[model samples]
Target: MTAGRTLFVTWYDSNHRSIIPVGRLVHHGGAEGDLFEFRYIQGALEAMERGFQPFIAFPDLCKVYRSSSLFPFFANRVMPTTRPDYLAYLEVLGLDPTEADSVDILARSGGRRETDRIEVVPAPVKDETGGYTTRFLLRGVRYIPGAEDRIARLRFGERLFWMLDAQNESNPSAVALRSADKCLLGYIPDYLVTDIAKLLEHHVSMNVFAEKVNLPPAPLHHRVLCRLEARWPDGFLPFQGEQFQPVGPLTAPPTHADHALQ
Candidate 1:
């Protein structure tokens, strides 16, 4: 990933039982200095109509927030290097502290906590190979009966397949991950459900496997890591739907504004 990367910020509306891509936090690197900015998107507007309130730190949805470093709200989510087990923390996420930046770490670990319903996801970038790859630590593990036991048997690099659960009341597009023996583990992250389904529908060549598995003592979200890669279909852009579009600029002139990222 480049220094100039954007991470999508999502808020879960528990009442609506939906996840909204409300804003984007962008990092821009330049010869002079690095800059970071956060701005609400059109989805925020819709979310507000659905009873969502702007976060206290970002009270005005229209005002663009610029900072020389990651905002405290997000920066706090990253593990501090001072911690003795900081490297071990990254290890559980299958990341090297030397290689993963705050943005990279947040993207993979999701920056999710019991405190709030916020999540940060890295946008999938196309590679020179005309393909793209991304990893998502599986969610809803505890909810699935026997999932914890099944995950214990998951071997690194073991193949996994997507199984659709159309009858699911919460999300009809819900897809579950399973082993060859059909040990139902968990569902895909809500954010990637639609995009993954589209990929499967087109019959794209995909490689899905167990990237890592950390047992108890690890948070539920970090329990299972999955790596998925697929050949890039022509003109494919993940999360390009209307909801993901920005209503405000990703990086403005350090002033109030409403413009989209280039």
Candidate 2:
């Protein structure tokens, strides 16, 4: 039963502290273009909330984590506070040299706690169908200056990665965030591309609740995702099939729906 779980690992630092509390960040995106990784972790947390045991791995800094014991909640199981080398930790897990993906890692422990640590969770979303009964709380809003195309699609397992910027006119100032259920998704990527239409049929963009309460604006990185999705071509698709699927509502309001206009 423990054969098919996924363990999501993320690395963080001072920048993450600016967006949200270091503790709540376990489920939120951290600095270093790791939002995609956090998306995987969010799936795990949702699993835990649904009575499933989920395992998440994060670095335990002496300055941050007070307890020598990493395991906090029954749902949130922490790995041993070893050093942060990827290959070395793989060895510590006693895994084979050929194992590259965390999906291959078996749950080492027995019982419930063991199973929770390895299973993969799906992203919480309300598809166009509006079928599922669950409603996940909206966390932080992120603005990616360059990821419009990519974030707009919001498909099954898509991930966004970037750094934090506090000086934007939208968010007043960089403040330490503490809410456990929500976080504003933000990241600064190393690369940006503009001409996404060369590779894809449709443009991508998101309608986020702006400071004006109900107004949803196309986020900053909407351009970035569009460009990356366009240039990379085959790299973005997890499966080799039809692409350009809309991840959110089919018809957004006129003002918020147009990323290409802005």
Scored by CA lDDT, what does every candidate get? Answer: 0.81, 0.25
Error of 1 at 243 (Å): 0.5
lDDT of 2 at 237: 27
Q: Candidate 1, after superposition: displacement of residue 166 in Å?
A: 1.3
Cα error, residue 227 of model 1, in Å, equals 0.7
Which structure among the candidates has the greatest lDDT? 1
Model 1 vs truth, CA RMSD: 3.6
Residue pairs in candidate 1 whose N, alpha carbon or C atoms collide under 3 angstroms: none
- Model 2, which residues run further than 4 Å from truth? 1-7, 15-137, 140-202, 207-235, 238-262
lDDT of 1 by residue, 1-262 (tens): 1266888889898886778889889887665555778878888888888877888878887777777678888888888888998888999999977778888888888888898889999887777687868889997888889889889988999999988889887788887888888888887788887688777767887777899999988988789999888987776788878887767545434422322332
Worst 10-residue lDDT window for candidate 1 reads 253-262
Error of 2 at 16 (Å): 5.3
